[model samples]
Target: MTNHNLYLRLVGDRFEKTASQPFLIIPGRRPLLFSELDRMTGCVAARLLELNVEPGDRVMVQVAKSPESVLVYLACLRIGAIYTPLNPAYTTAEVSYFMTDSKPQLLICQPIERESLFDLSLACKVPHIRTLGSDGDGDLMHGLESLTPEMTVVEREADDLAAILYTSGTTGRSKGAMLTHHNLASNAEVLHSYWHWQDQHDVLLHALPVFHVHGLFVALHCALLGCSTVYFLSRFDTGQVIDRLPDCTVMMGVPTFYTRLLSDARLTPELCSKMRLFISGSAPLLAETHREFEQRSGFQILERYGMTEAGMITSNPYHGDRLAGTVGYALPGVSVRIADNNGNELPRGEIGVLELKGPNVFKGYWQMPEKSAAEFRQGGWFISGDNAIMDQTGRISIVGRAKDLIISGGYNIYPKEIEAVIDTIPGVAESAVVGVPHADFGEAVAAIVVKDGSRQLGEQEIIEPLQGRLARFKQPKRVFFVDELPRNSMGKVQKAELRDTYKESFGSK
Candidate 1:
């Protein structure tokens, strides 16, 4: 009777000790306690059973980050269904691709997305479709009506698939990562132990979207393990975050959140004093933004590293020395290494591809054995497509994405290293570096920068600072000013898209 899915086991453990703590809090809505979420999930599980939603059945949810969305995810886990969270911002085509590829038995979506999604569902001719939202006038809460169907929780196994998270796929087609109950449960426990999350004392502010790993799985799942209060946000807004600061103890966000917070006039030392920890991930944190926010708020943002394939790899310590530019050491139960092009282990100080092997590594890309095999090695190590260098002090600094490497005039250049230096400049707000075809150099370094002030910076002024830091060929030959860089849902720079946008300019040469 006590056994259920992976999520229920963990929740049962915490509820026995700390059930009265605030489990979830939305800005304008009432907060839910652990006991409330527990009851809600049970009701949802019972309803799912009545609908004959079997174990391993695919269930899709496309809604904003709210208590209902959170509850829906837990219900799927408690009853042994594979949860699929979709981006609310996805286009009809993008949504259709996932729906057709996964072929889920049921699709749950918000009101605004319902019409387009329903058409997609019918066009794809899926089996079932459900919509949520009071205004949408669909089967929103009707599915949660009274039901006490038998609990099939005991049949669920640790290796049973829990969720199928689709990669953002900014560069190419999206592939689903099959995360098992064991994979997710183990990672949650690892983060709970490594981050030292305890019950009844911490109030976490959750502002990131649920589609990404950082927001949905890492932060929310980790907070549930501790029975901490989750201050939810439908979407991230700097003004809203600053307003809630007086009561929140913990905050997790991406680099874009920090940049906006630093520019907000509402943030002050007194307002932020209530927070004990501030975490950033899903994208690299610029060193300049790190220093500026620290100087302004007196809290050094702890930057961590993770991906859709692996839940969370490394994090700057909560108590120890938190470095500004580095992503700190690998977390417990995880092994990280830097390797050369041949997959040989490189020296500690050298920059190379980063490889990880641990309990948190995903099973593999869903059904793509060839691509999956290429991503892994003879051992259990999963080769992340990221480039990194390890310092003597045991910190890992990401250089750039390996696929984003640019070759200019026979010299190899990493965009992240260049962007880092450009980010340090006073007038520059953001920058993206790419390679363009050149008749003379084979490819030339191209820079796209976003400026904050009216200061006009020429190509020479931008490339001068890198004279000694980079080789002559590695320096950018042309610099273009832009209002903003193209970013995906997770705020990651879409360099491939930029390369395509400027392909015509390269043809001029």
Candidate 2:
């Protein structure tokens, strides 16, 4: 039997060959070397063992991003414990639901939140609780100086649960997506090779939050596999990104990062001349933003498509044409098809639900067997609720989520189509189209827009441009301008929130 623990693969040979090399470069602090990281994780692993955290035990973490928080994650992997990370911004009530759902044996939270969550932990029957601060001082680190490091890596099967990430509960209660060691390792290996990660040569600019897959797994795994250095920012800052762009070779970000960077005049082609790749994910990247970035930076942003269940299913080729609106082809060993609700495959160039099957797909939703069963078809293909179209060349273009499709007056209105036109207008920063309740039309098409500070625009200014471009029913029945759109922790626009805010836009019949 093979020890399929993901920690072993992540640190393969690097502990001896490049143990002293810098792994994380944090501003205003000493660089964390590979050996130092190893020792720290070992110490943390020893502490976890002391607390009786055994293999298969759930360890829930909800602390701000820090090197120590990352160490906790690595330590969980080292000891074969299931690591569950929640967004630090989640309120106590929100966390209460997750605590009840995950039922973790050990809970790690921020120092300030420990007191408030203590009673909740007690109520949830969590045996142990620890604290870890953003600045790396908390109960979790106390008394570590007196403990010996535990360097032993626990053995695990490929199918063993490694992590459980809760989906952003847009519809109902959030479901935990259970990821296995094989699911995580296979995706990391594929991405490392597909992205052309260069060992000891590539420097990654990591500004994403560690709680989500984009930052926690996709970005860190590739760097770890390649033994590369990372310029780790606490969060995405335009100035810090500009200052580091000349030194970093690769950058992974959400669409908001690019839009914010484009807002700054300091971002230039020369500043980004040394950058080898700029990848975007977690949310849809607008075509206008995509082309505008290339026009200014002299490099096309490689946009990939993925969800919490699957790490990364497809990506724009590293050495080929990166189309502005397409997410390129299915990665090697992954199969993708456009299908209807009945599991019948659709022809190319037609919009339909995206279904995929691959080694990287997660096992199932944790503790939700019936819900998990419904997400997959008889042929083992996971039915992704995203509406998409594939061209003859196999390039995938995501139209929108199926739930976001507005059926108004017996017509199907895809929000992305309206948003694309609205975004092209001058003084428009971004737009989100949603379906609001209507008395007669069943649901009315509505647009919530954020305007660029350069100009003052009216509702008609936004709605008038779509007269000849889109059908009358597709045009927004109501246009509302706001300072900005609501977003989740991962920067995806909260369309459900938008729908809720405008639910009574047309008034009851």
Largest TM-score belongs to which candidate? 2
Instruction: Encode model 1's per-residue lDDT on 1-509: one tens digit a residue.
Output: 33436766566446755667678776656677886776777777776665567789888887766777777788888778899887665556667888888888788887777777787898876777777652323475575646653334545776778899986332345688988887888888888888777666778888877866788888888788777878887777777888888888889887768877887877777888888888987666767778888888989999988878888899899888888888999988899999987789998899999999987888887767887888897788898888999998779998777777564432335676667768777678888988876643445788898988857787776878776544455567788888889999999888888887775565653
Give me the runs in candidate 1 sitting further than 4 Å from their true place: 1-4, 134-138, 149-154, 169-171, 405-509
Query: In candidate 1, how many Å is residue 400 off?
Result: 0.5
* Candidate 2 per-residue lDDT over residues 120-233, each given as its tens digit: 999999999999997788999998868898899899999999999987433436689999999999999999999999887899999999987899999999999988889999
Least well predicted 10-residue stretch by lDDT in candidate 1:
405-414
Q: Give the C-alpha miss distance for residue 328 in model 2, angstroms.
A: 0.8
List per-candidate RMSD values in Å.
11.2, 11.0
Q: How many backbone clashes does candidate 2 have?
A: 0
Q: Please report, in order, the local distance difference test score of every candidate based on alpha carbons.
A: 0.77, 0.87
Clashes of each: 0, 0
Candidate 2 similarity to native, TM-score: 0.81
